[model samples]
Structures are given as C-alpha cells and as structure tokens.
Target: MKPKVIGKCIIEKEEFPDGRIRIKRTTEGITAFELYWHLEQAQEEISKQLMGLLKPDIIKRR
Candidate 1:
C-alpha cells in the first residue's frame, strides 16, 4: 500500500500472506557519492530473505 508521496520521497508498504516489504524512497536529495555508497553495499534480495527469516523491527534499527 502506498500511503503518500512527500517531496521526493514515496512511502509505501507491500504485504503478502506470510510477509511484507516496507520501503521509503526518494527520487532526489542524495548526492552522487551517497548513491554510489548505497548501490555498492545494498542487498537486492535481502528484504525477501529477511521477511522469511527475521522480523520488521530488526530491519528498522538498521
């Protein structure tokens, strides 16, 4: 479910029978170096596996 779009950020949530994916995104504001840092260390499937193995609150802390 997409709650709303504020400025460059889109706050949304995705739910499934067993789990979900909550995401916060921004189309602008970050610098190029920040983008590179995120892209370099990000895990694309970590969310899916995380939902399978852990809980949302754990992710919220990181």
Candidate 2:
C-alpha cells in the first residue's frame, strides 16, 4: 500500500512473505525525512536524526 498522510506525518507499513514487517514514518515539511525498520538495529540512528531535524540548535546547547 502507498503511504498515507496523517496530520503532519506520513506512515506506511508492509509485510513480507517471510513474516517480516517493515514500517516507515516521516514528516511532511520543508525538509524531507524518513525512518526505516528491518527488524531493529537502527532505532538510535532514527532518534538522533529526528532530534537533529526537530531541533537543529539542540546539540549546540549541550
């Protein structure tokens, strides 16, 4: 299925024949963003990327 827009976010989900499910979530705005899942291993990366996009100046404060 195609991605669906909900509020300011776009969400999509797919299931593989092998029983693996993938999900993608992102926001619609000036800067494009995306998140992917392949049975874990990139959660931290996604979180960091989201924080950077949501608050670019946050890192400078630390």
Candidate 3:
C-alpha cells in the first residue's frame, strides 16, 4: 500500500528553563507520533500479523 497524507498536522517546539529543547508534531489534539502509532497498529491488525510489539513497560522508560 502507498502512504498518503490525510490531514493537516502541527509542529511545535519548546525550550525548557534548563536549556532543553523539545519538538512535537500533533494533529487535532493528539500527538502525531501517537496518532501514527495507532494507525500502524490498525494496519497490522488488518494484515493479521502484528509484529510491531512494544513492551508493557515501555511508557515507564519514556
């Protein structure tokens, strides 16, 4: 399948007081990364083979 851009997205950059920088991409209120994750999972489901597994503790590490 070919990939397509379905909608508009927003990119944001932030600087912390400690001189740290963070960049994020979002669409509608959902972060683009998370949105892509859900889309990828859905695609895997349709293929009947979800190999892109993440550990249950992955969030804690992040």
TM-scores, all candidates, are 0.25, 0.34, 0.34
Misplaced by over 4 Å in model 2 are 1-7, 31-62
Say which candidate scores most in lDDT: 3
The residue ranges of model 3 lying beyond 4 angstroms of the native Cα positions read: 1-5, 29-62
Q: How close to the true structure is residue 46 of candidate 3, measured as C-alpha lDDT?
A: 67
Q: Which tens-of-lDDT digit does each residue in 1-62 have in candidate 1?
A: 54332236556666668786667654545665667667766665667677777777777789
Question: Pairing residues by index, what is the TM-score of model 1?
Answer: 0.25
Off by over 4 Å in 1: 1-28, 43-62
| Tens digits of per-residue lDDT for model 2, 1-62 | 54643347778998999999999988874321233333244877788888879795876688
Q: What is the C-alpha RMSD of each candidate to the true structure, in Å?
A: 21.1, 16.3, 16.5
Q: How much is 10 displaced in model 1, in angstroms?
A: 15
lDDT of 3 by residue, 1-62 (tens): 44455567889999999999999988654555667999999987966643334543565588
Error of 3 at 19 (Å): 0.8
As for lDDT, the candidate ahead, 1 or 3, is 3
lDDT score for candidate 3 against the true structure: 0.72
Candidate 1 lDDT (Cα, whole model)?
0.63
